[model samples]
Target chain A: MNSRKCLAFEIVANPAAVDALCARAETWLIEGGLGTESFPVAMLLRESLNNSMLHGSGGDPTAQIRCHLQRGRKWLKITVEDDGPGFDWATRLECRADIENCHGRGLEIYRLYADAVDFNRRGNRVSLRRRIAEVMTS
Target chain B: MTTVQVQKNDATVTLEGALTVALAQELRPQLQKAVAEGVSSVVFDLGRADVVDSSGIGLLIATHNSLKTKGGRLRVANASPEIMNLFKAMRLDRHFSVEGRQA
Candidate 1:
């Protein structure tokens, strides 16, 4: 059986911290033997984590957001948790129905890129899972 | 990791390299200024863009919206297959006038 490995990170809810988070996630994906899935994974992670910090936490630099990346033989799991009050994801979904709209595409991007997405009761935490081979082929 | 070179006409911006969050931030102000100055018929040349995330897409949409409000148009060119797939998944092709669609 192939061993599964997981990595975690804590970041401030500032937009400037996005680069660092993405860099670390890329490194993790590369080192974990999922290099082919790196691009899409990075994109999905950027959107999810950015939304958590930017919208959920209202870009509060003082707030903390936790991120986790897990790699298995055939699956990859990502989770992002924020400390801000959550909103109605259903309403957000409706707002993104307009493709020409400038805003409200973050979560939609997450849905498009990730194989599966889940939000907690408060909607402040998100979990994304993707099949490694499926992502690579896509 | 994006480099923007404005054409002599000031109507075309050639963006090179990845359009990540940090790079998108850097390009946002320059584009906003161009749109504000009444630069119409802008072309965002993405032939060399290797990666683009939500931030990059958001910036593109904002630029398109800004241009349209000024009676101008925004066109994207030379997007890679991977990028095209991303745009297709997000239905961004309908929002931005991409040069070609191959996906």
Candidate 2:
């Protein structure tokens, strides 16, 4: 969180802003010479942003979700927090596997893209970190 | 999200839309019917499929797994690098045959 080149954007609880946030992050990854990782990064960004917008609203946008993105030496760390009562991460995880499931696929997509995922204080916030480099096997 | 291209011999099930939770419910049955009878193969053209959230992709993957066990095969064609990267991220590219094509 305290790096000379660390940049943060206060993402609004809007699905529209997700695209803009993704474009910004992709630029950074490309400039950082991690261009190959952009696709997964974009997916990760979209999923988390949508989750915050949907969950942070609490069935209501009076509540705002805060998304923080930081660039580490070898990984890009993203933390999304909602100002609401958090739920259990395990229960949500189980829903993603069911094809007939209705919701919570956004977080599941995030888990697929990120190298490591952790839930804090129930599910009010999530911390995700993904490696900047991945080898392509043709 | 569901593209139906009726060919001379069979029909191709091409999907080029968002396959999130909202879309998957309607999509699964469409694919199931495409190859219901004695058709050739259902080529899932993901060329223009932009956002394939985990649920939609999972449905296809699970279908692919099941089809293979029942003497059938699912072929995925025309996936953009961006979309294919999704498969790469989940290490699912190893499970299916992805044919990248031009627009």
Candidate 3:
């Protein structure tokens, strides 16, 4: 039997909202038996949401950010979309951030943690997936 | 929130909760003030912090750069395993000291 759970929600583009949403999603994933996958999942959510709020929406609190999370027995998928003018994601993806730089590491985090990452043509939406770690069974 | 303890040229900054973009923005001035005051060695106590985003990582790198110019250094202590993994993954451990919490 395939046991998969999914959640979708929207939040204003703000730090507090992002925090709350991440916390809620973390709890939901934990309750769904994510085990060791929870931390990286939370990190992925944070980086994506933060990028949407700070860069995509320019920290406009009124901007709406949409998130969708799907947890399957072997994988977890996340998608985040922001209502803002997207950037040239192709070039951005090719460029690497210097270690000393104070910005531009958000994409690096996503790339490191997520097994697969893709951006919409407009660059305002991101979808990523991670293979869920095995959960212990009694 | 954050608390700072200073002793001559060394400072210890204790941070609580997530070190996301908002906290990084709010804490930037205080950290800059420490650098401005000639605090050469700064230790970040993240025992209470559970999460750190890219902005938070950027803040740490910027702080390290600020201190390096003064011949100072930044040390991160008592990071949770997840945070430690992040630092190591970014190769930040090569730039400065990062310690995970003791089991």
Candidate 4:
């Protein structure tokens, strides 16, 4: 085996901080020869981190949200983990049958954006992946 | 949630900020009032919205359905990039004339 070199970032769960994280991720990816995948990866990262901070951490200002970004020549893997109660991805994404009204579709949206999603035992850990081949770079 | 007071003549309806659920109670009256008042178009500004989930997108769809009968049109503007991206991803901007929230 060669090596699974990685880059990780611990980001606070703040809406305002999303833009900067996205910019950094894109910049890093581009400088590493992964430019075209910039926008989708950015979107996936922001949404996942936002969900972790909001739902996973329950808007706890003090709660810590950490993001791990791993990319290689073939794929980019993004993971978001939080220090809070993990939620059930399946149940929450389901529409409420009893209630006539509902709010929030964050998880569903994230699913739509991420190519593949996986959760962990604590439920606080989530991993999403996208193929580098599909992204365009100039 | 933010509240937007839409004044259509005698009818005044309030739309919740980053609308996600379409409560007939608030939306219908406002839309009806706009029609009753001969308002040419009903514009909703989403500039203040930092984020919008699917429920919110549902509300816009519901509003569009309701307004189609009145010969009145619905418009969305001021969508922050956050919301704008969602709209772009879903092609909602094309489905509706979501002008810039120039606000």
iRMS of every model, one decimal?
1.8, 5.0, 0.8, 6.6
Q: Give TM per candidate.
A: 0.82, 0.62, 0.94, 0.59
**Which ten residues in a row are the worst by lDDT in model 3 chain A?**
A1-10
Across A26-128, the per-residue lDDT of candidate 2 in tens digits comes to: 7876766667777777677667666666665674444577777777667778787877677577767555443333344566676678888888866878888
lDDT of 4 at B73: 62
Tell me the tens digit of each residue's lDDT in model 1 across B1-93: 344555543566676766766677888898898778667777877877766777788788888888878887888888887777878787777
Against the true two-chain complex, what DockQ does each candidate achieve? 0.56, 0.17, 0.85, 0.18
Q: Model 2 off-target regions past 4 Å?
A: A1-4, A61-63, A90-111, A133-138, B1-44, B49-51, B55-76, B88-99
Would candidate 3 be rated incorrect, acceptable, medium or high by CAPRI criteria? high
Per-residue lDDT of model 2, residues B2-86, tens digit only: 7677564355667765555445556677656654554445567777676666556756675565555556666778888777766
Q: Could you give candidate 4's per-residue lDDT for residues B1-103 as a string of tens digits? A: 5454555522222344435323323454555555666654556666655445454565665556556666656678777665677666666666567655554
Best by lDDT: 3
lDDT of 1 by residue, A92-128 (tens): 6445546666666677776677788888888888889
The segments of candidate 4 whose C-alpha lies over 4 angstroms from its true place after superposition are A1-5, A93-104, A134-138, B1-72, B76-103
Lowest lDDT block of 10, candidate 2 chain A: A96-105
Task: Give per-model CA RMSD.
Answer: 3.9, 6.2, 2.3, 7.7
Give the TM-score ranking, best first: 3, 1, 2, 4
lDDT of 1 at B44: 73
DockQ, cand. 1: 0.56
Report the C-alpha lDDT of model 4 over A31-115, residue by residue, as the tens digit: 7677766656766786677677667778775677888888766688999899877868666655442212223445546665677
Distance from true location, Cα of B85 in model 1, Å: 0.7
The model with the greater TM-score, 2 or 4, is 2
Score chain B of candidate 3 by TM-score.
Answer: 0.94
